[model samples]
Target: MMMEIYKRTVVGEDGPTVVTESVPGLRSVSLGLWVRVGARDEVSEQQGISHFVEHAVFKGTTSRDAFDIANSLESLGGNLDAFTSRDVTCYHGRCLAEHLDIALAVLADLLQNPMFDPAELTKERRVILEEIQSVEDTPEDLIHDLFAQSVWGRDPVGAPILGTPDTVNAFTQDDLFEFTGRHYRPSNMIISAAGHLDHASVVEQVEKLFGSVPASPPARRAPSSAPRSYQHYYRDIGQTHLCLGTTSWSYIHPRQYDLLVANTVLGGGMTSRLFQEIREKRGLAYSVYSYVETLEDTGLFSTYMACDRCRLKDAVEVMWTQLLVLKECGITEVELASAKAQLKGELILGAESMSNRMSNLAYDEMYLQRYLSMDDTLKEIESVTLEGVYDACQTLHDEQGMHQVTVGP
Candidate 1:
């Protein structure tokens, strides 16, 4: 069966450009506004502005106060949320299909008309600082930050999405305004909605509401050369959290599918080698896994583990043993088959919701520059062989691919 994807582009008078897609359904609808700017686009001084701006947008808008904004969404039984990553920041809402218009309007207001109230800015700064503190409290999370710093070194990809307290506190209203205006251009924005709705009518409403922003050229930067290896911090926690990884493929790389399958058999699932060997058999760690993260230009394959401080060396050895085994022996046909089945199941189950479909569509356009059919994606996963998985594993196990960071007692 062929999946239908509907798309429309809205050109405005003076504001940002909007691109949207519709996935027909009767249940929930998700409206997502994706902006092009993120941490990678910022200079050292401007580090956390993208994430800070994400928070400030909800403080208030020109026409609605923060409470009013929250109340409006609540009244429609919708949930509003936003996240900033190294490559993009997205503001999204999920609601009943009938409430799509209200959700879209709220998203538009938050993105374009934020008030940046001075008092609210102060309040949010404290809120964000507390968020930073909260993350520091989680050793598992904190170690990844340290590991990212180790792998990417001083590059933007290595930077935390949450700005440090110094940068977050130093941000002024002018900084928020300047960053928002420059990065939130029509051409750099994507508005995607999926659920029960008429495609043409949805396009019309979006055009009426957002058709006034002018597209501006976004700031661009050259890519960083891949790092050989780097390490920075060693913090004291009861259980040591360590991440060992190196840069891999990007979203567009042909090897990504093979890597995904390989990761599944290696650590992406509960039955993965890392879990079976480390947690089930050896009892070295309650939490240990390997996964891959692909960015616009580069990617990372990492193994994360947290265990008793005394067991740190053993845990590292166990993880390294598994890597060596994977590189030399690779996966069996049965394992490859199991991994493919699991991967296919996840893809189908994930697509049952409009929100997932909408986000998937937008992500395809933004990263891959084109959407692969569900069948095509599934076929790609199915095509991954034992040898392919082994080759991918070997590449990752090479000396140039290894980087590690540890935080513990």
Candidate 2:
């Protein structure tokens, strides 16, 4: 199966910007046309433009109207969707193996020939405005964005991937075209497909479809330089939303596997320390968990909980205590082994989904620039020693690295 995984970067004027991956044997296939631009790539005024473009691209393409675009794949028992993130935008979908070419053609058409109609842009602007308002109405979701803004400060990386109402309202049709032209280039794109598919044939299709779109070098934003810090916002809400986090390793960090174990032991699930201590033992909140976001150049370790305003102080104090305890004493041998096993099982289970495999393929090509066999990845996870977990815990929990954000009255 290891030898069955194939990845190669096509080279030429019409060559693919990055390599593609194919993992056979499944009855269906998943494909993603990844572009290297998102919220973080936009200037202050263009905050949500990347995400807007994601929606607009699907409104219609040269060959497919929005209705045809929506039904083209579904009529064949396939799916289609796209999303924008802080670092990248992905147009991805899944379908039965026999329907791979349909998925590929629709996706290629969307990326290469989006109509971006003025009427569609007008309708989407209102849709996005409602989306921004929905987030404002959901405290749990809004608080994380607030936490990010607080910690990352003025950096665009900290900005909400869904831009503010003002920015969303300001995007014009020309703005959409300008953004797409600047960033939607072969040089900044990675096309990945996984499951029952032919690698050479997929490559040929990509070259023929995308190669015609001339490549343009994007003027990307400079790397973020802001230091992590805290900001507390007062809102007259029933439950308080809070987060404590700090910077951690990037995607390529050597000790990230150890960090993964440390995070799991801390609060990766219901059985995690944060959940057990904060929710089960103390009854401080209905929801509590710790998570890490590992990006291309940076990462974040954050723990979030929503609890009664009265117990806010106590909840925060308990969280800090656990952090200090982990930093000082490290996780137990029992906990370390459990976390490792859980992580391994999750990786194996996740691989079963064609969508996940397709996503993994895009990420590896976009960030790692090489294909890593499933065995290779599992071995990396398996190699994290108990001592390594301790080191990771101590470093991420270093007192100076921590910060806090709380949102509620």
Candidate 3:
């Protein structure tokens, strides 16, 4: 099948930004307004406001009451949702192509004009506080948070995107308003749409709605620092939850493809070394895998496992031994081929929907500043070799790279 992608730039009195493609096929379109600011952009005092502001945007807008917003989307059989991550916040929806205009209108209203109602703010604070508490209650979730804190230290990336109870409770409407005013600008945002839409018409609608908003000065850049080294945490839980990680590379790094294959062989799939060795052969844990999280400037390769408390130390040692094996002996041709096949299959399956495509487009534009066709991405993954995988693993296994966090009984 031939995949056609359109690219254009919408420039107005407000600001200029790129919109890559609006795919046309399904009855529903996935649309999103992505902003560069997220948890990492905030200072300690402002840590959770990025996420808080995301929630507040749906409370009400100048043109649409919260009820009206909900009713309008439901009337059209659409779903409206939003998420805040370490690096970005997205307000997105999946709606019938016929409701594209309505969806865009509501989205623009929320992005540009949330009222930040005082009572609503108070209620949401309670909700978010409960969310923080819930995370602490779930060992699986809390252990990762502890792991992140151990890995990234106290930096914004290490900090939970959802602020702590103390911070979440302390947040006021003023804080949300201040954060929104600073980060919610046309230049800082990208409006991406996919499935059954004319790219030009969507661009025109976006320009009309967002045209008058002024661009703010660029966001302050985050500082660069050396990779963090090994640190471990001990906690009491029935099963030992562990996150072992090391600094890898950014999304744009040259060795990214190699790292991708290495991760797959180590932990990406059911047949991966960690899964086969730790789970299948030894029956040490029900869950064991490795993966990579790549950001704009840096990345991490992480292996997560949950095993009986008695087997925790052995699990960690076995995981590390596999890493060392990959670095020293590398992978076999058969293993390399299997990893490549699995990675290709996953990519093909993941892009089969408009929502997935919309998210891919938004992330590519935000992080890589360009869109890569599916064929290009697949070709890169397919071309990875055993030597390349070994080199990437070696880089990740540097002494200054590893970090660990464990929670157990």
Candidate of highest lDDT: 2
| Per-model lDDT | 0.80, 0.83, 0.80
Which of the predicted structures, 1 or 2, would earn the higher lDDT when compared with the native? Answer: 2
Candidate 3 residues 267-348, lDDT tens each?
9878899999999999899999887878887776789999998888788889989988888888899989988888888888
- TM-score quality measure for candidate 2: 0.95
Candidate 1 Cα deviation (angstroms), residue 293: 1.0
RMSD of every candidate to native, in Å, equals 2.2, 2.0, 1.9
Measured on C-alpha atoms, candidate 2 has an lDDT of 0.83
For model 1, the local distance difference test gives: 0.80
Please provide TM-scores, in order, for all candidate models, with all chains considered together: 0.94, 0.95, 0.95
Residue-level lDDT of model 1, residues 1-409, one tens digit each, is 3255666555555544344444544667777899988888887887788999999999899999888888877887888999999889999888987788888888888988988988999999999999999989887788777777677778887788898998999999998998888777666787777766666777677776775555554454535535566453556556778888777778888878788887888888689998998889889898888888887778788998889888877878888888888888988888888989999999988877677877877788787767676788898998887777888887678676578777776
Per-residue lDDT of 1-409 in model 2, one digit per residue for the tens? 3234666766456445535555655688888888988777878998999999999999998889999999988999888999999899999998998888888889878987999899999999899999998988888898888877766668888889999889988888899889888788776788877778787777777766776446654554444534556667888889889988887777878789899999999999999999999999999999998998888878888889999999988998899888889888889988988998999899888887778877887887777887777788889988988889888987657566567888888
How many pairs of residues collide in each model?
11, 0, 3
Better of 1 and 3 by TM-score: 3
Model 2 Cα shift for residue 31 (angstroms): 0.6
Q: What would the C-alpha RMSD of candidate 3 be, to one decimal place?
A: 1.9
